[model samples]
Target: MSEIVYGNLLYPQDDTPDETVLGCIRGARDVGVTTFDTADIYGMFRSENLLGRALAGEPREELVLCTKVGMPTAGGPNGRGLSRKHILESVDGSLRRLRVDHIDVYTAHRYDPETPIEEVMWTFAELVRSGKVLYMGMSEWPVESITEASRLAQELHVPLVCHMPRYSMLWRVPESEVFKTCDDLGIGQITYFTLEQGVLTGKYLPGVDWPAGSRGTDLKGGRGPLMRHWLDADDALTRIQRLAPLAEDSGLSLAQLAVAWVLQHPSVAGAVIGASRPEQLHHNAEASGRPLEADLMSRIDQILGGDLIVHSA
Candidate 1:
């Protein structure tokens, strides 16, 4: 398929189309990002509606639509997980908001430990069979869980096609074994956080209030416990400073350089760009076109201290 270019439009709760996103969506369409990533619990189900309205009259066929289910929420008992209730209810709710008959890719937002895998697989298999979801995938899944999921899809005859993982210059954990596993399984790997939530963007310096202008600064659920804007900011700045010359020689911005690094991998199918505004969208789109030189990649590996890969959970 023509290189799948998608954006993670996360609105996790009644978030309005802030001026930035309104312009960003217009810019995305101006460039060539027609596919979008979203989730049921994003903005408490308001994210999809906001996106749906922004993209209201665009031709459905022109867009490759996708969304996710199975994450914690505030609604009710069926508000989370991959139980039959949540999965079925979520798909309908998502469809209603997205205003689409079928989703190109409907992913399990996370592994639902409380529910049986068989139930989740069976319910989703039926959705695919009924023509609601064109294809399916798993996100933030452990390698073993993904293997198990692949096996279940096989026995159930459902096609599990892609994997969404956090992969970037900082989070290279997927490289440990996830990339190889995906390669062996024939599942494409789509990555996000490629810039380590903008740490790799070469923007943050040793002491600048952690660059409050970044999407990473405004992420939902707060930064993870291990990674805060302040604690890691110092090291990130140092790394970027060290890598500046390499990016300079290549004539690319640090953000583009980091993204290009992720795309250089054989296992990466595509990189997901999260945009808070139009210029960022254009900037991200432009990065895909910039070629990552081999020598530059080697330099980055050295500057990042050690392997910048993420460990499998």
Candidate 2:
């Protein structure tokens, strides 16, 4: 498995042509990236369609294709949840769109309070038994929910292999409980937001306006609102700037340093990275397998002090 998994969340933008998207996916594969992750809710199912078309003729065994379910895909009570019906229907849709016989890792995008843990686990087991999904994963779930599902997975003999979480130097909510719980459960993590939506790249200055096409200025897609926390925190932005010198000392760009920091964790199996341009994939892929010294890690923490960081629940 590749250390860096290419995420298709924001790829194939509104104006980007199908050919361009296909080239980007092939470019990522050529750079040694083997895992590709997308979701049914991403781009309202357009992402999966595009990804399916992009990877049509690739060697299926060499790639790890993952997609998610359990998000509101339609308007009605049965539209979205971990219910057996929804999961069953969603898997077929994903399979059709991805042009795959079976998914490498099928993840639950969010916990479904409306569905019982037993129902969720049994549904996943059915999928695994039928060869529709090889492994199960959960994203952004509470510790209690993950534990309950894990317990049920064990009872059902299902393979609950990964937990997808939003983990980064600036956002450390997983450190408080999720990390230890997943570690104890023997579940690897595939982390997203490792770059904190590009804030950790030191591109957005403390005082200057955001770059023209940056996510900080993308209001229509809801990315700007997600970035407001860091954008509004001048002290955090200033602290991020301080890390630039450290990144230079390590002979890496700020973005590379950010990606490397997340991959340093033992439980992290891979970090999901999104690339709009093909060159961006090559740049970010350099962070894989590069180890940072312990002293450098400590210095990074010192530079971005605890006050500006969220290190716990």
Candidate 3:
């Protein structure tokens, strides 16, 4: 799988046309990005539809298509969770939208407290056996839940291959327990929020107004609130800005530096990145295979400081 997976979350934005979004997706593929990640709940299912249209003619065997279920897509009680009915129903909808016979990876978008772990594992196993999904995994699941599911997966013969976690320089909670547990279970991590919602990209400067059209200013769609935790912290912004000089010294953009930092982890199989433009995708793809020296890593740690980073859950 490609280390840089194009994430179709907020892409194909309400304001952006389908042609522009398709162009960006194709541009990512042009830059050697073979893995594309999306979910049924993302963009209320439009993302999967658009991604399906974008990659319709490509050789299916050469690409890795991933999507998630278990998020509420409708108002009814049966509309969500990892129950057999939901998973069984959701997979067919995902297949129809993605225009694919089998998803390379099908993940539980989040842990469902209402469902039994055994049922979840067994349902996923059935999908694998039925050829609707190739592998199974989870995103943002609790550590105990992951361990329990991993155990159940073993008994059910499900191929639980990866864990999707929110990991970045600013958010280091996964390092405390998730990484070790996944590593022990022989599962690789495909991390999201590697750029801290564009904060680590050096676009939001300390003591300065957010750049026009940035996530910080997007009050609609709840993006602004999602980024408020970082945007409201000037000290964190200041520290993030300090990394710019280091990024330049290494001949890398701040976004590339941020993405590379997550990829540095041994357990990280890939980093999912979202981009509105093709050039952004091209720039981030360069972070793959680039190693930051130990000295640089230590310097980054010192600059961000212990208090600003979240090292535990």
Candidate 4:
């Protein structure tokens, strides 16, 4: 349960070599990264498959293998969603791909409105009881769904331990509602996009074309669309430019500063980041276990401005 968890999004995508992905996973372990997060839909289940190979010969007890279901892995009505049929079927595939007997944490990749929450809860309960999945979590689920699921999970005695949400200085939607809801339910937040798809890494500058081989370059279906709003905003870039010097003064890289900022929230148990290279993993891994000063946090808020933060009910 470290402050930073590794993600496997960039792996298997962009045609990254198997050796490199394996090295990244091993490198993460060398840097003391305990938990790795991925989903079935990511790289069309190839992410988990590669992770399985990378984790070969590693101590399973020491590592937490977290993978998500409910995302479409193939073309079909039953191919996705949190339906009992899908959950039951998908867990086995994830287990097979991860090369594990059981998943440490199995999360719903997204909210499935088609299926009733009761069915989802019961299915998760069965998985936990059967030892196919140790814990249940959700990603990008609405506040209302989380509230209802919390109630049902308590009733079912299912361990809903954490929530995975997209949270960053640029993406404050979680702050508006998801964070508070999860907090009230005693669910820790292991957030993704802590670096805003590498936007906060100080690598993407305003008015300049993306550097070669960057995620912004559609190297593997870049996060361009998801981050378009922030990437295109001149004001956001200016804020990032101003924050860079402050991070340098604090003796932290911009990436480290961004990670630290997200970790400052008490409800955040960890932040998830993707790595294409071992050195990238090593650099971001440094962000964990470091506390930022309150003054610096306030300064960051000032730089981002009040309007940037979305506070929801």
How high is each candidate's TM-score? Answer: 0.90, 0.96, 0.97, 0.96
Sorted on TM-score, highest at the top, how do the candidates line up? 3, 2, 4, 1
Superposition error at 124 for model 3 (Å): 0.7
TM for candidate 2 is: 0.96
**For model 1, how does the per-residue alpha-carbon lDDT over 195-232 read when each residue is reduced to its tens digit?**
66556666667766656745446555435554564246
Quality of model 4 by C-alpha lDDT:
0.86
- Estimate every model's Cα lDDT from 0 to 1: 0.75, 0.89, 0.90, 0.86
- The top-ranked prediction according to lDDT is 3
lDDT (Cα, 0-100) at 294 in candidate 4: 87
| Model 1, C-alpha of 135: deviation from truth (Å) | 0.4
lDDT by residue for model 4 (71-181), tens: 777678898899999999999998999999999999998999999999999999999999999999999898899999999999999999999988887677788678777
Error of 3 at 9 (Å): 0.5
lDDT per residue as tens, model 3, 110-172: 999999888889889999999989999799999899999989998888999999999999999
Name the candidate that leads on TM-score: 3
Candidate 4's C-alpha runs over 4 A off are: 11-13, 309-313
What's the best-to-worst order under lDDT? 3, 2, 4, 1
**Whole-model alpha-carbon lDDT for candidate 2:** 0.89
Error of 4 at 298 (Å): 0.9
Better-scoring candidate (lDDT), 1 or 4: 4
Candidate 4 lDDT for residue 68: 93
